[model samples]
Target: GDQSWTCFLSADNFKGPIAYYIPETWSKIGKLFNYPFLYGRGLDARPGIMGGGAMEINTVPCFEATDAQGRVYSRIPKLQFPVDAQGRAYLVQDVAYYSKAALYDAVKSWRDGGPACSGRFNENGCFKPKLNTRTTRYSQAGKRIAGVERFFDTRIFEGNVWGLQWFTNDRSETGVFPRYFKDEGEERVVAAEAEVPAETNLLVQNFKLAKQGAPYTSPTVGAWANPGPKLGPFNVKLADGSVVTYSWYRFIDQPSFQQYRWSEEKKAKLQAFVEKLHASWSIDRDYMPPPTRGRLVALDPALLVTPPKGLEVGYVPIVTGQAAQ
Candidate 1:
């Protein structure tokens, strides 16, 4: 809980052609359109320092999902980042949570078809129809929908950015980490905020393992900072006055690592396909600027401590059979 999250927004929101408010994904006619990792694309892709020579940069919207009784069960994509479209940069979808494996596979296949996938958008109707240029996935009441699991599926991590590795948890379709991390302890509150200085180099730390470098961000709206495939407990910041502070909270899914030998031809084709996707470009004149920083105070440092300072550290006493060796 002592760790931190990260987020990055473009410099053009205040000066761009349009502004995109991510909570509703393009709610304004003049704002750049944005979507969380769960839905899909809004602005056109530009360029960045990561994947595709571009990256997503923006403030993330946090929407809570709940059931009939108003019991919160799942929250969709938690963050978003931006990419360049033509010569301009725009926020794109970059993160998501898979509450159920069945639903996850279904939705993923519907949007991004690939290995083991069997669904697609127009054919399955998994998504609600888009209402307007600034609208997508609205409820019957026509309000934006979020805060509950309409379908069943295992929770999953769907974003990859920076030069991070991938990892996964083998939880059953009914369970997920981070989403479930809170269940194991008391509630987590946004205890405090630290004002970030502008113009700083960014780096992140994935808690489960040791690695340091620029951290990964979601390509969609509403994402927190994390080490994409590796998972996190991370910290981020802006070092100069040119930009304020950016932070994001990220969860990880580390799959078992291994090597599968591939022949030259197969590897070459795969690499080329990926390259082509990265090369496509456009100019998304619309963009959303991040809200200015209001609070720069550091989080309550007291929250970072373990063992309650003077109390004895808790440890399980392991029993040794026969005191051997």
Candidate 2:
């Protein structure tokens, strides 16, 4: 219940224009246009790093099917992530969840064509009309949607960022994580402002996993901090003076790992892989393709732990913040 779940899609392997679609009814001008259609375009692809280079960007809309009345089924249901114009569903490429059941439901929903329409602009995104039933089946889409099940085997590291933990129990699907970690928790009442040693590199520890350099935290720390049940609830002050609360969980014992049909082999393998990641992957390391432009940032800055007094390097302290009293 500590962290927020995010679904990040990559266009690296996408053959052509990278884009996503939304029903016309949902777009700002959908009603004005009066049609059954999809409004989508190749989202502008910016360089991962600043001033990287120029790249092709595309913007295209879709109007596949219309009714006898010359009206398109424009009011079709909202869709989930990884959907295509043909009505095929796909799994999130890089995602983080609070628990295995949550992960399982996400995958199952995609496999089952998801809800016909879970309502517009809802959490899980919108549900698309299955245009290509032949290929929409799990058997057909499974290979393309591969690796989602693999998450079932990995340990979930959970935590709340800037007090956004509400999403974990938030059934409304309206909760969202803050874009920037500002030191406004005191005013927000989600978290109380706290302090660490004046010399504590809060920026580095807070953004420790970020790929961007100075002013931002380095990806690699001098050594790994300890992880434990008693770890955080720690208040982190970022370079911009925003305070964020972070918490960490033991790799395996974290609640999300509990409900699965995992084998000892798979668990051990994943554990070993995590160890390897800790040892070799620097906070600034480019494990995945670096975006062509714009500086890279951490997937979740909360992953790193700044150990409290007397703790040694091998231990990565779990981080969390104290709630406002």
Candidate 3:
């Protein structure tokens, strides 16, 4: 139970136009809006339970805009990041719950740079700007709606930029190795089903025998591999000049050998290994945290920002074995 966990927000955490727009817009209207209260309620509701929390919040911001009738409407902005076969990330904005005619006008305005409704604006006028816009159909709020979506090439940005959710436990090899490496040895069998020349047939037979005699050796010598490098001790300075720290380690799945033996000796060895690792290693740049649904900013050691106070350390136990389930 000596384990601990903590979360921190860094400059690299924000990605895409919203990332820039959120802080900038918030600077202008954030004071008028109760962000902290809303955030608390959102956290309590626990939306996207299986996904990263704050990252999901960034994708949908409560945007306020006015219509031609001078009516103000507030809606959560829906964004999507679709990656192509080449591994390029693209941003798609979905305009939900709008009339078909209005959606058409919005797309046309964004594409042709004519008088268009600026959702970012609270006033009743249209702005002219060049945009690579497209029309797409998607289901939203239990209804099929037509809306205009915009596409942006995110590679131009230097820091954390938004796109699709890339990091998940299924994709990360934090405390685990590939299943192919789990087994030992290889099998030898008939090389060809068709008949060949006598000399060629003899050669094939010799090769099969040779393979059967030698067999294949497994790369893994033992049941479990070594624990990867330690991550964090990420320190954030509070607005009051106080500092908080966070750290993390991957919990390896229990090895096949230890699954049946629930002995104290095995537990003691595992504990010792964790303690030794904590005492000795640190995560290197080569082993940076995997890309997540949210953007992560690499902090500059020289410039520090004041974070909120009373941040508590969280503990995530990386359990191993069948008992882990």
Candidate 4:
């Protein structure tokens, strides 16, 4: 089945500062697999409908998860974390597609109302009442344009303080993983650190396996000077019968930066900055404003965490990618 190949589509007019699959393509892929986990990104150089028709959209039997809850949390055992037959796990772009769809649907509903205005606008005294009137086009361009605006509403870009996206001196960071949640309602739980292979790191091990002998430098995962308040001990059992462990670390506290080649002084400075944030910011408070147009899904109460002591809360982080991060 071409299910082994995965493809991404991005467009300028489309939603988000993030990449989004065009509606037609998303519908096609959705029909193939409600929660599809492909082995690799097809063949890199091949070019066609889907990277040179690598996807067997019609013939492959659609795969489904047995767990009722597992269906919504697509990044769990069956979908996002699967190890291919070759024993490789690729980095997943852990966005909650279901939540994304819900956002799309909300915009559609709003547009169906046939609103006159395209988006939220401010007037400096010369406002007309007809500007807020309903029109049939709202179901068409109104919805489409509104959806695009809703997607990029967040401050999830570099240089923004307290948004989903963050940036360092060298790079910009985003995507779901190392998410925080309440102990009882946490969307997904991973393995304990002790269960995984102590000698081999998951990021490094998986990086080499995925690279398949390509000439690439091994990446590093750094450690925090004062590791505090985290969740996990959650585990993912690989196809090779090995288990990998992960946890939910604060956005800044996560080991993502360590994967790069940075000077010790730089690392220490970042860690110090993280420590300062940890002391000041509570995870429970909302740093970014709520979405004005469409409903933002997956900010579930069940997934709510009672910020432990000094720690507080913010965005509902859902990891849609592989554990290699």
Candidate 5:
């Protein structure tokens, strides 16, 4: 079997961003892949199409912010957090493909003032501005763009914001792999293409043929159970026809914690408190605290002072010598 490499395609006029992979390198791979069909279906029937060579397209909405001064800023929404193979986290922005100047102007428009105008028309019937607020306008898709729940936060850039294609978000999920849910009224997962890699790798890495004398236990009940040693090595074929072998025991336990045993009501309260604390911080402030005197000085909200039943909270406050007076 010939190996195939999956590739993603993006264009402004695409109804759903189309993706196709090169199943056979020689069968019009270069021509079909590089065809410039701006606003029409492409390669409907082509040779060497493996499994139809077409994939489900995922769309991300593009946004434009305009001010009363006729200045406009545009951006394509992006995912902030995506982890790598080695478990290192990195910030990832969806493909913007905007020129440096355009990106900077867009960010600047959102930061200085929003896209709304606060002034009234003058005697000449010309629109005059007492103030200009940048207003956001979405593409034809309306509010829900790219599965993003909220509009882009200009404050994420802080004061030193630039036109670069990269940024960060504190609200992003912590792992490289995202969690998926079953589709409504369907037992199958919604995004099989995205989940297949993670699910397959997880099964390969965790398959245990024998049970240990005692299952590894954690301090908290209902934590993930460790099923001792794995049976043997697992092999997966890569896109380039390379078979990579992975041993189960080679996978080490990454740092993790079980949720504190709290009632649903208490958990809701704690979540609300944390949200409020986050809101209290200045938007421009980075979520990560700067180290002071070789110590990380983090704010522990007063709501966390009392522990829930069967749980305890601990911290040591770093006091400055000057504050002692």
Candidate 6:
């Protein structure tokens, strides 16, 4: 174990010049899935309400609108991570509609006398209160999020950071950080709308919506689409050198031209059919495989790793490497 200490910070509003003991061993790394995975969010862009004849995405006000409370949602807390479909990682914006809703609900709840404020203030006197008073984290009603899905891990500019939105030098020399949890000393608490986030507050509640993305859809599984066949969500790469995995919502291990003899007439017809299907699908383009000939590694279930007694399922005997079927 190791010992560490920072300046004791209670007077200035920060709960730390933190002091603590640390374990010698670092934890295992985790799978790199899509961060800020907004579960249950409708993938369709928010539609434009119209009084005219055209039905296009022209009328829906951007996520900056004042709510029932005087609190203005001027910015839809945009975040960016370097992950996307074309196997290219770049900074992108994600709006926490759910988080804003949770904040909105917490404000309403506080107005309803839900509970007292709970959280330590920060150096700037801004504290992101725990969301206990509102739909704490996840629920069916009000501004609260459904769960961790609503909460995404991202570099605040990683759109702004990536966009260089903060300070050119403040965020220079080193990367800033990500706010991923609701903390006040130790326990989690919700903040009322009346309370602004204190300077010391690191984590806050939030969510993602689909209107923030392109109106494009995913490809569908066809007779030609196969498990290892490449697909594009961001930029298409016939071949790339990055180490990654390739995961699809459904593996398209269907038959392709290989199953047929060389025939241009038949090939063109089949290609046309496949193209039509691509116009209306949105399968998840996850799973980056290790570099090789690009041949997929399928795992044989017969070799499934079983955990020893007392360990959680799939947590122990961690799934390592790609499947080599």
Query: For candidate 4, lDDT tens digit of each residue in 179-288?
Result: 11111132222222332333333323221123323222212222532242165434454553343444455644444333345576755654454444344434343322
* TM-scores vs. true structure, each candidate: 0.17, 0.25, 0.23, 0.23, 0.15, 0.16
Superposition-based RMSD of candidate 6 using all C-alpha atoms, in angstroms? 27.8
Query: What lDDT does each candidate get?
Result: 0.24, 0.29, 0.30, 0.29, 0.28, 0.27
Residue 227, model 1, lDDT: 21
RMSD of each: 25.6, 26.4, 29.1, 25.1, 28.4, 27.8
* Model 6 / residue 109 / CA error / Å: 61
Q: After superposition, how far is residue 124 of candidate 6 from its true place, in Å?
A: 51
Q: Write the per-residue lDDT of candidate 5 for residues 54-110, one digit (tens) a residue.
A: 112356443333334433323333334433443333222121222223222332343
Residue-wise C-alpha lDDT for candidate 2, range 1-325, written one tens digit per residue: 1122233333332211112221221332444565434233211111112221121223212112233443211111112232234322222122222232423354345434554321112324422221211111111111122222211111112221011112222211222211111122122111111322223222123312334333322122222232234355456655544555654444543333443445888666555544443444234323223343334333334333445554332224333332221
State the TM-score for model 4: 0.23
- Candidate 3 structure quality by residue, lDDT tens digits, 1-325: 1111112132453211111111122222324574554432332223212321122222222323333544332333223344555444534221122222323344345434455333232212322222232232333223332211212222322233433322223321222211110001232111121322233222223211212222222223244333321443355444434344433333222333232333766555545544443333222222122344444455454233222232211112221211110
Residue 121 displacement (Å), model 3: 48
Q: List the residue pairs that clash in candidate 3.
A: 5-314, 5-315, 12-297, 254-321
Which candidate do you rate higher for TM-score, 1 or 4? Answer: 4
Candidate 1 lands at a TM-score of 0.17
lDDT of 1 at 80: 22
What are the runs in model 3 whose C-alpha is more than 4 Å off? 1-74, 77-141, 150-263, 288-296, 299-325
Q: Candidate 2 — which residues are off by over 4 angstroms?
A: 1-233, 238-247, 261-265, 291-325
